[model samples]
Target chain A: MLDSKQMITIKGTKDGLTLFIDDHSSFEAILDELSDKLSEYKPKKDEPVVPVTVKLGDRYLNDRQKKQLNELISAKNCFTIHAFDSNVVHRDEALTWKEESEIRVVNRIVRSGQVLEYVGDLLLVGDVNPGGKVITTGNIFIMGNLLGIAHAGVNGDRDAVIAASYMKPNQLRIADYISRAPDYDSEGVYMECGLIDKEQDKIVIDRLQVLSRKRKDISGFERRMLNG
Target chain B: MGEAIVITSGKGGVGKTTTTANIGTALALMEKKVCLIDTDIGLRNLDVIMGLENRIIYDIVDVIEQRCKLKQALIKDKRFDYLSLLPAAQTSDKAAVTKDGMETIVSELKQEYDYIIIDCPAGIEQGFQNAVTGADKAIVITTPEKSSVRDADRIVGLLENESIDPPKLVINRIRNHMMKNGDMLDIDDIIQILSIDLIGIVVDDDEVIKASNNGEPIALQGNSKASIAYRNIARRMLGETVPLQSLEDEKGMFYKVKKFFGMRT
Candidate 1:
């Protein structure tokens, strides 16, 4: 009989307790060991409920397995699940992430009553006239003037941003929040960027330089330039 | 075959009928056979503008419904021997003329006329669609106002989806002093938004209204600034390179004295 303690290990950290499961064991064996070990363990008297993080190293767990593991952890009265950490992700999830990070380049004017929509980030090379709209699930970057409507982070990604050379849009939306241009004429001579201010829960326009600090992972070339 | 051009402005009261009348008359003055088709059906105005409302024995609907021959529906202009007007029906609605009916009528007119100018009604509904269906080319007219320019942009966008040639722009009703004082939108600004080839610019003149009221197109007068502008537009349509007419007012002797004294007028 192999030692059961080698399949699962627990360590105390500043935040809470971390449970590491061995990838070499079969999923059924891991489940059996987890249930046996958690049930046999006794909590110290008056010891408050400790948050636990389960780290699955190189292990893939589908929804059903994850649910079973979560149920087993919850049955233990002394511990609460803080998070689930995994080294591997499903192909579909990785594909969605890759798509969200990609930038699509388009070169055409978006005229009035026209709509240009994209799944990922959009990089438009021409102007967006009044009554025109550009919608995207990710960020939007316009090389020409933006005198129309722009909706970024359309899929509820609050971190998405909108940047334009001449940002005089009629209306701007980031995630679920909507904002309109001020009544006074604000003809921006320089490029500008718009993002959601989480503190105020409002869409705020800022200088283009703010994008560099906010979106550090936007482009590898920019990062290389900064590092050099 | 004649080139069919639809003169359209998405908004109402921006001088669409007047433009159609003047362009048709100007082409006639150039000695070219021109036919003007009014597509505003229930709200017909092109005939009134051309001063031919009394001679309407048959209308476009009658010709389309085969109630009369095409020649019988054409009302000859009193001033121009080569110009004719096909009035819209005041009794029927815009839906009375289908797209196929319009195409047939315009194609028949094209075989005889040198230029067929269609005066499209306002808005992007059936009337606008019926007007543009038979045309080979489009001309979008707009004033310097924000609303007019925005609507013109929408019309230009819609026209792009059609098989016709790229639509040209005409900025109508430009006031010189207001433009100079930065009160109205500049010509450059309107062009920037619409982003289409500009065919011509028409200066706002009271003479246009007066000529329309008298049932005579301003282009036939050959004296007013509006008349000259319309003539230039017509010449441009005939493939002539006509320079844009200056919008500056004629300087008087008092204005010249002010310039000599280095004083603002």
Candidate 2:
């Protein structure tokens, strides 16, 4: 091979110093280069402790290797670790994130005194009868009538929404805000959605069509499909 | 084996005991050997409804606690030779009876009787659980009122989780005038909300309370509308296909004549 390529490159910006480690290099070689580069590096006297961010390009690091890397960086007294940024994640962590973000579908009558709950978004295909409850951490989409209580964003996600085909629910909750149905019977002929109004700091019921504007991220796949 | 049916309403004073007494009596009139168990314990009323409170020497508690044999505690009905009442213990609380205990008692009674009707106590507590534990089928009773229908829905939900067959519904205390005036819930509305099969509907008749006060079930009467409704329910329970009685039957001949002349009653 020609001259050995640099495995570790350091750059400086307004925020702090950034170390970009070459992923194609062997781990031992990268570690040796990082040690050598850090040993020779010097900060200005006026700013002795420079915050450094380490970027591993498309490289996944296990806990032990991450610990070793942190120790090596911390050994340099002139540098402080800001964070370790990585482009790749372990399969298990990726799977958990996928699970938390995916929508869960359920088809059954949620009768009185029964509670249906999920960790992520919920899509219920049946009616939620009075005295029943449906809860989720993300969003709720009821294809049938929702006559009971529905709680979206149980873990405090304020942006979550609850949409129902017939929205005469006993109560609606989003994040920490709760609002009971009005005493008078609402004309439940049209579909409705409940969400948090940040300006008023209360839950508000709106037309279901507002969902497209309120939660634009939920329509990304549909938009892409339409574009194609 | 005889089928054990539990008559329950999640709310109080929805005529569970009355229905139990009437159905048991109607079944006995059909010549089937019937046993009625009062699971209300400290709040025993089935015996009084069946006019056998004075004859309750030994009770369900006595049978469950082994103080008396099952047959010894069963008080024979005064009207029917085959009808019997196992009154609940007036002194003991609901906690005295366990699910397994009720199961054992009901199964033991099932061996001899053609039908065992259990009167479940109100509220979803130990009393309700004990009453429902031994039943093979359930009849959830509700009125046309909102609160009663809500409670009945809860009872139906709880019953669905059990191993027994899906519970049937009986819309009791219906008022024809209130329904006509739109002041009360419609029978179709109640059935749609409860989402269960309607076995029968009993109109709001003063004769029901009068019969209960005299410790005579209305089903014993031959011509009363409430008695006919109870008999129809009993016949339906026996797998007979009896069409639901029309509310028009309660109207007078003059109302019918006015309707024939296109005049609003």
Candidate 3:
């Protein structure tokens, strides 16, 4: 007799919008609330935000609930919905609802014969075993082992990356590129993956060295990591 | 309290029913109250194996659909008072019972017996789902052959997704002499690949075929190599830690010399 409650919270970012849902709330109620808030931000002539961002709660959402959430977001023009469990991955990016999409999945173990698909970036704080698969339209990050299949940018975003703590997946795919484990024994940094270079039209993978980028003003989870 | 264990193999013709018949009879002969439920609806054989088919007036579907009471459907064993058979209905389909329905029946049977063993149907369909629905534990049976092992792996995957914890493996129809001569896979290979807890190892015994023809389970006779293996499985289900009988002892120097002379073991 354990039922979950769904709560939806909306906050305006400097660029666009941010919608957040806390753990295990009524999904139907959250959708109704989201529809009401979305109508309020239709488009003011003064607004300059590109695409909106919505953050989802970290918990098990059944297939029906997930499909319903996806349909609701897609109805809005150029909007992105991010889902994550706070208990799993602690996000740190700072922006008004106008920026990056976030999605978090906190499962104990992704069992065999179960196919888990997400439209945005996925952060898994659990293991993906032999028969299970994680398919995402954006980047995928696994805090635990990736022993099964992990496909990122499933919709053909070549820049998407698949990172995990223990990357021993049976198969790895990003965008349209695919890679299986090499026949020879090999090991490098903990996070290893298959990625594509658009300019070269070639797929290559090695150790994930830290990328250099301009540091942006950070707050919340990102700010905590920057300081630490 | 008897454990409700389901013997499931995702592939057909891999000896699940045979294993169930032997294990149930073995447990009964050990003085444990046992009821074997054939959940294969439309193709029930537990009654035939137990030689109670002629006496079967009521079946599991009758009891479940409320056409009859539980006691009326139970076929008492002639060999042992502790054993009974709940045969599946040959006319009904898998949809005749749901997972919840099976759970109710198992929970009720659990109160009256020391062990309730379910014989699951092949494939990952509704029948398989119903069989494991109310099981407290599961024993995935497989032969060392490739096709059987592949199906076993698939079943293991399904069980994990369903969150059935720590399922035990029972390797059946193993041929030790064939393994020594590089003709068959050894026990170590199967154990390493499946990566699950082992309960028993049943050897290929001619006595099993002989007993089946007579409509008597080898476990009741308690002399064939397969019967001892089934006894080990029953003990393991009872939470007894009994190591498998050494295959090496069974395949001693005499069998080795027979192999040297190019004789078929």
Which candidate, 1 or 2, would have the higher DockQ against the true structure?
2
**In candidate 3, what are the lDDT values of residues B178-240, reduced to their tens digit?**
889867767786765466888899888889888877889988775678888888888888788
* Ranked candidates (DockQ, high to low): 2, 1, 3
Global lDDT of model 1: 0.90
Per-candidate alpha-carbon RMSD to the true structure: 4.4, 4.5, 12.9
Where is model 3 chain A poorest over a 10-residue stretch in terms of lDDT? A211-220
Q: TM-scores for chain A, candidates in order?
A: 0.84, 0.74, 0.46
| Cα lDDT of model 2 by residue, B1-265, tens digit | 8999999999999899999999999999999999999999898998888888888799888888899999899999998789998999999866779888899999999999999999999999888889999899999999999889889988988998788999999999988889989889999988877888999999888999999999999999888889999999999999999999888655778888999999977
> What local lDDT score does residue A213 receive in model 2, on the 0 to 100 scale?
89
Order the numbered candidates by lDDT, best leading.
Answer: 1, 2, 3
Each model's TM-score, in the order given? Answer: 0.85, 0.86, 0.64
Pitting candidate 1 against candidate 3, the one with the higher lDDT is: 1
Candidate 3 residue-wise lDDT, A1-228, digit = tens: 122443666677775566677666666667777777567767656543244454654655555876777677757554655442333332323332112345556655565566778766688887776656899876778877776789987877666777787777778898888877778755533775556656667555555553222112212244333332
Candidate with top DockQ is 2
For candidate 3, the per-residue lDDT at B100 reads 76
Provide the overall lDDT of each model, using Cα atoms, as 2-decimal numbers.
0.90, 0.88, 0.76
